[model samples]
Target: MSETIIAKRYAQALFHIGQERSKLEEFESELRTLQEVLRNNQALYSFLQHPRITLDQKKQLVNESFQSFSKEVIHTLNLLLDRHREEILSAMVDQFLTLMNETKGIADAKVYSVRALSEGEKKRISKTFAPKVGKQTLNITNYVDRSLIGGLRVRIGNRIFDGSVSGKLDRIERELVSNK
Candidate 1:
């Protein structure tokens, strides 16, 4: 099976467990930390992926490194390591976070503006866009991009709502070209 499929399956299982334990948010946070650790440490990831590393050693390392995580989270990591599927850890965490967000009626958004947005502006954007996307709220990550010229461009999932000055100018240009 494909990696994504496998990841989704694992995520679904973990999500169900989290739901049962009423610790979905905690699990998500731990999973994000695990993903971050893997992303920031090449040597550790390589060690996990190395074929010569014994399964027990990998499990012991994971246990030592993530001693503070919940039993479920550690168990999941060990399970992945046992199966030699450590490469899919990030994908699984992503899928798990997606599931958790969907369950909580939240969407992750990226908002690009010419300058950093104030908290009030972020709240306003979240309020305006969330309903349109069938989500209760958006977890917005703001990015400053001078190329935007002005206004904001919001991305949720695969859709982008471009309201920037540059975007408007591009649209006008396209229209003028098409009219000719």
Candidate 2:
């Protein structure tokens, strides 16, 4: 099976387990923590995937590293490692968060602006754009991007609402070229 399909399957199974245990948010937190750890430590995955390392050794290392994590999360990690699906761990976490967000009627958005947005600005942007994407609310993460020149660009899922000056200029250039 493709890695994405496998990742989604694992994510769905974990999501269901979290639902059953009334720990969806807790699982999300744990998965995000795991994601952060994996992101920062490139060698960790290398160690897990090393040909000479045994599965038991990898599991033990994971268990020790994440001793504070819930049993379910640890078990899921061990299962993935056992199945040699370590590469899909990040994708699985992303899928799980996506599933949780869908259940909660929320969307994760990245807002790009030339300057840092204030809390009020973020709230107003969320209120204005969330419904456009059929979501109740947005969990907005603002990124200051000077390359935008001015204005904001919001991305949710596969959709992008580009109100940046650079974006507008590009659109106008395209229009002019097409008209020529």
Candidate 3:
């Protein structure tokens, strides 16, 4: 199976288990902690990714590292590791976060700007996009890229709207060049 699929399966199984036990929030927290640990510790990353290490050893290390986690979390980790599916940790984390956000009915939107957006600017953009996109709330993630030249890019799910001044200029230049 694909790494993303495996990871998603693991995350979904764990999310369901947590929901069944009425510990969904805690499960999300434990998964977030694990994600941070992986992000911050390169050694831990090496250990998890190293194929030379025996599966048993990796499992033991994972268990030991997250020993403080709740029983449910431990069991889920133990189960996934035992299956030798640790490589999907990153995808599992992303899927888990997505599940949490979807459960809360939060839609994600990416806002690309040439500069940092102030709170007021973000608010205004959110208000503007909310009407256009028809989402009740916007989980707007801001990105700064001077290469955009001016104006902004907005991605709402699979839709890409490029209203940037640079984009317009490029299109006009292309048309003029082609006409010539």
Residue 99's C-alpha lDDT in candidate 1?
A: 95
Cα RMSD, each candidate: 1.4, 1.6, 2.5
- Please give, for residues 1-180, the per-residue lDDT of candidate 3 as tens digits: 688888888778888987888988998898889889888988887887788998789878977889989987788777777777767777788898888877765667898999999988878877778667666667889999798999999888887779998889989999999999
Give the lowest summed-lDDT range of ten residues in model 2: 45-54
What are the per-residue Cα lDDT tens digits for candidate 2 across 132-170? 999999999999999999999999989999999999999
Pick by lDDT: 1 or 2, better one: 2
Question: What is the C-alpha local distance difference test score of each model?
Answer: 0.94, 0.95, 0.82
Candidates by TM-score, descending order: 1, 2, 3
lDDT of 1 by residue, 1-180 (tens): 999999999999999999899998899999989879878999998998898989999999999999999999999999999788988988999999899899989999999999999999999999999999999999999999999999999999999999999999999999999999
Alpha-carbon error at 128 in model 3, in Å? Answer: 3.4
Give TM-scores for every candidate, taking all chains together and pairing residue i with residue i: 0.93, 0.91, 0.83
Candidate that would win on TM-score: 1
Lowest summed lDDT over 10 consecutive residues: which window, candidate 3? 129-138
After superposing candidate 2, which stretches have Cα over 4 Å from the reference? none
Better of 1 and 2 by TM-score: 1
TM-score of 1: 0.93
